[model samples]
Target: MNAELEARRVERESSRVISAHARSWQLVSALRVEDFDVAHLGRADQVILDMEDAIDDRLKQQARDHVLEWFAGGGKAWVRVNDVTTPFWSDDLSALAGSPGVLGVMLAKTESAEQVSVTHHRLGGHVPVIPLVESALGIEEATSIARAPGAHRLAFGSGDYRKDTGTANEAVAMAYPRTRLVLASRIGGLTGPIDGPTVGSVHSLLREQSEDAVVLGMTGKLCLDHEQPAVINEEFSPSPADVAWAVDFLEKFEAGGRVIRDGSDKPRLARAELITRRASYFHVDPR
Candidate 1:
């Protein structure tokens, strides 16, 4: 009976993934306007509006208005405010949180859970706080940060983190921090501990960076351009080919009570690991 139930569950999940994959492709195909164009105002899955240096009230109001408009039109918007301890932080939070379209604040350079909790309390618990782990200290304290009140997600700031740690090459320098955020988010049951943005123009390089992020268990990425969205989405979304391959791999591996490989025959049985990848397409492609 248990085996029969398990088989049914697998069948249901596979069907769902296939349907979601089709929907994801449809969305990508339907993207008609450039990301910077007004017509494409809210097409992005997630947009980070930064207000780090906006000291003028008028400029801050304009920034808030722009973000609110983006959110109201259908995009998820997060404000990357100035440092929490800075003078600009309070006004930025008040303006953004009061705006109808803003969903949350991306607390830049978060050092502790206490900072997030306090900010949440100030926001009246109406908005989510996504902590940006941008320092060696932040990475070291990631688990607590994930558990902070109103912290729905954690995002790594690769550039800032590298600067803070005085390291180069994310592949080698940020490996431990990336892994730490992923594991911490998993243990804390958060939606994502997002990988940071790629800092290059080469499409292949960005794709490789995204692939490395996936290997490190990040749920999504921070993209600087719309073109990067497709690569990130494709990496996170399970293709029809992937679904078919997984089904075959699982059947063979379980039948033989051993690991099975693809047509290339290279021992690739990791059925459980495919669950999130397969489900990712059901929601917006977070890039």
Candidate 2:
């Protein structure tokens, strides 16, 4: 019975490794684009528009226009709209929903799933909604928020979250929140959560910050500048070494039939962990 069970596990692991390899290849082969060059970035798989303080109708319209152009150029564009509770909520949604280029709307300061649902109803289901959790309340309500209709992804709002929690802008301080968002996103069956941008100066610091976020299970990092998208892409996208290791690990596990030791370690690798590792390769760095 034990041997039979081990065979099943091995089979499952092999299948997982194949899937991971295919996914990794897709991610590495995928195109990437920068922020300001929305038209150029539109060629990539995803684009993010940060509309933090553009409250006026004109600026909002301009933002919507740029996003629409990006979509027209054949890229998936997601706009980070102002907080729903703010005065700009109605205008932002109304403007974006009417734009043909906007594929998704990311709601900032989302405290509950109800907020997402409300926004979806207001937009009349034109685009998917991603909830950005930036406060203690948002973190606590993450699960419900992820389950909300139109909620396709969960994002961490690092700067606002740090200010709200009074936590230092360091990896240790942000770890808990990052993990919580990842857990909630997974439970709610949303796309894996994206880590907040590193509000630092040095390139090395930013790289380290992104690595830390990756360790905490974030699939991607947010960016404010175009240069940042490249930096982010380098970090989130797995290196050639990572691909080699995953491939080798799976090969060894498969050879052993029912039970395999990973690099002499007694325990076998979990299927989920293997998938996560493979998924990491596809995560583009938004430098």
Candidate 3:
């Protein structure tokens, strides 16, 4: 059984290749073991096994056991563990230490650099740890948190953030926190931050929310449902028009000896270069 589990673990690790530019991050409740299957993950670029916020206190152990079983059975995913201040955090770390199929961990309710450093250490200091900044304090400490050891990237816990600050869920109301996270990630030399999930069945609304996040420099989004990934992915990715414009601009600039005509030329060149690179990364061909 041990050898078979190891084989499965190796196979699982080898087969699942998640991109750093993955836009759709779907979170599945650890309590719902059935949802861990590939079929249920839909088009999500990545999946997170949520052990915090989704499970009740009484079922924490059961949830942990289920996640371990899934990993043992060849499931691969990032796990959203409880906050550092919680009793569940220690047990969560212990259960996940040396576990196969753990892509990384998302530390919930992270408000300080110490929490991120401790979680990273507990996870053996190699696995990526994304801190979910969810409160005023976390937002205030955003840069420090992003600079913490093992901080791969930051994610916004928008719902909890709104609740914490009595702010509305509107894009205008949420922009400050989202912008803070984006700036912090950049300053910390990390990739763009992941925006929080949208909570609704409406595809148009999801796209709009995803677009808002994208405009605020969030390259990825946490999604709540299987159907939401496609929308988030589409919205977050560079559009065909953008690719076409980038291709045209680069060709013209190269043909013109790459001369900067004015102040606007520099920013335009930067934008064009960025778009083409992102297009290539996302496998989007110029139209």
Candidate 4:
């Protein structure tokens, strides 16, 4: 990275951070041609017109044309194209380039910061990108990818990753990768990375995973089921009850309660502030 390019990278990274803070979206729902209309009913924070995993290889061209029609008609959404190395990638890019409907591109199986730059250049304009990092190598380079010039943020492809690493999809099995992406986003000054989905519409499991993401400092999640969005949004956000608790704790701490004024006062204050900050995302006007 030359000085000029480094400067440009910094500028774009700043844009990404600003863009993330200004956006209140929390859930990303993947959709195919069959589900396009339902997706527009607004059940999700963002819709990914999936051309990679969701569609069969034989139907790739059909999916591309359908998506192109949707774009040309002025509909807007992110398109999750195949990886850069695949044949489908160029075709997906060709269909997506310069379309007003493209909110951004979600580059599937993103492994390197350089790959993000290539996707950005090929897009022919300054479209924000969310790189879906899945492989072990991708997770290792997560910080670089998160800070890459065109990347808006990162998304963990948990299922594929589990397959790659031969690990179960259990939370403990997936913890390192999840934590890596989340910390990388924070380090890069981007909004928290989007965590992967919980399958089978299991509300209990969904809530558990979503809460885990929140505890790990992630605010957004990729949702497969439509109902998963509400769960993700709720779990990531500090509810009114949480706000109340934070306020009461702060007040008592200010009044010098021994427990509140204990050695942990500083961390308590920071926690309260973080609770309020998370609450603010949902327009939670504190009373």
Candidate 5:
């Protein structure tokens, strides 16, 4: 096929994957497999059994064992394996090769499209991979990573990126990287990128962060703890007011262009359509 046809085909497939994940605002609250049933699973839109940042080097083998046991018992989740440069990453991929329960792998500290490709190849191409960009270099390569062969989507690893670059933990300080990932997702025809967790237990902070993420075009948020998932899901969802406005706007805009074009936002109308579609698909009753 020509390049245009190939690009269209990829975009179509990416859209399919993104739509599947549209409602999964909260995902894989990274937790040890030992605590899987007791905590992480079923609490969020999705769960990620994190073996990378959550596990210490000494506990790597033990954590891997627990993860394997969980999968053996028919459990399912995305696993956040260590970075590609680490020895643990090779082992992590090896363990995941024939595992039945891994929905995907969230490759931490991903810095290139090549790493994303190798990850899929190493796992034998059985599952989709979401590259978790965590460093300055990773953010620089965000667009390429998003467009990579195995990348289902890109996720921001805000804390690590901040630490690596000596930037503050606040949203404003991180806006550059955040916006980069967002634009990269769009440019690469991938899903809206996943935002980093809002760290603290403050409810207001969580809402503010999730709302900020929504405004910046993220479809999902990574949850760091149990209390975060509910708040993230609700905040990421379309508000009653938004749904009502979307319903009203769609009716007016569909009637004709001349009546609504004065001082109205064309781009916002498209966003309204998405809000309405999501609300309808999720059976949300707008007031």
Candidate 6:
């Protein structure tokens, strides 16, 4: 690569590091190789090549080939593989193992810890395995899946989850599952869990749903549209006001010799510290 091209590649590689706490996880279908432009990742902190439900069964092999070819050409992304129950899961693993640019794998419809462990082991136990919990049974078993030996993080598949439970997509209806994932992530020592995607093109609706995820303690969200990442990143990030408050609070706490004056002090200190850390990591400046 030329100097300019090498510099751009380095920048995108840095973005992938931030993706460890990525707010917007954008999904590009493996069937659409034309969309994998690193220059046009928009505000997505991470990109995922989906090889599961998004691709037709008849074209599964074709999609897999496209993903591998992209890897060969120096493209980097996480792969959302087929569920362990499917025959295609093995094929997905076979193609992904030792593949350059395979950042990690997201296991679809994950229902058990064993599935996560197996997938991680299949990839030689080095690649991270993020489990997408979509079914009612999966929700019930979420903590185990989160604590599983090879499990990296958890993501909610809200659309399929609602279908499994016959529930509405409203926040009130989905609150329980969202909270379950959040608590499970904490218990499992993983970063905050990723929430499901909002299913509309309306920016207002997308913002509303992303804010709802924040309120429910989800730190990241799956995004379907390229336009959705900017909005999702904004909502998931600590706002300037939040950073300002945290900075001021920490200064005052330090001035007071870090003494706790009331029951609220400890929680406030924790919150402030968390906000400051996230602001620093996300490159948010206090306004």
Clashes of 1: 0
lDDT of 5 by residue, 1-287 (tens): 25664465344434322324543433332444445754333336666777888567888887788788877765666788889899999999998897988878899999999999999999987678999999999999999999988789889998899899999877788789989999999998887888887778899988898888888888888877677877876777788888998888888788875536644576778878899877765556679
Q: Rank the candidates by TM-score, best first.
A: 6, 3, 5, 4, 2, 1
lDDT of 1 by residue, 7-63 (tens): 653444343322112211111111222332221232244555666533364465565
lDDT, candidate 6, 109-210, per-residue tens: 999999999999999989999999999999999999999877878999999999999999898999999999999999999989999998889999999988
lDDT for every model? 0.64, 0.65, 0.88, 0.76, 0.78, 0.88
Candidate that scores best on TM-score: 6
lDDT of 4 by residue, 1-287 (tens): 24664465344334332335322232332335556645544446566777888667788898888888876654566788899999999988888888888888889999999989889888984988899999999999999999988889888898889889998877788789989998899888888888887878679998888877777777687776566666766676777887987878877777877645467878878889888776665656555
Scored by Cα lDDT, where does model 4 land? 0.76
Candidate 6 TM-score, C-alpha based: 0.95
Steric clashes per prediction: 0, 9, 0, 0, 2, 0
* Error of model 4, residue 144, in angstroms: 0.8
Off by more than 4 A, model 2: 1-39, 42-45, 54-76, 257-268, 271-287
lDDT of 2 by residue, 1-287 (tens): 25654465344433331211211101110122233343222222355566654336446556555555655554444577878777777877877666666657778899988899989888887578878899999998998998999887788888889889899988888989999998998899865688776655578987998889878877766665435656766676666665565556566766875447346444335542454464554542222
Deviation in Å, model 1, residue 259 alpha carbon:
7.2
Instruction: For candidate 4, give the lDDT of residue 176.
Output: 92
Candidate 3: residue pairs that collide? none
Model 1 ranges off by over 4 Å? 1-43, 53-62, 68-76, 249-273, 280-287
Q: Candidate 4: minimum summed lDDT over ten consecutive residues — where?
A: 22-31
In model 6, state the lDDT of residue 73. 68
Can you give the lDDT of residue 16 in candidate 4? Answer: 31
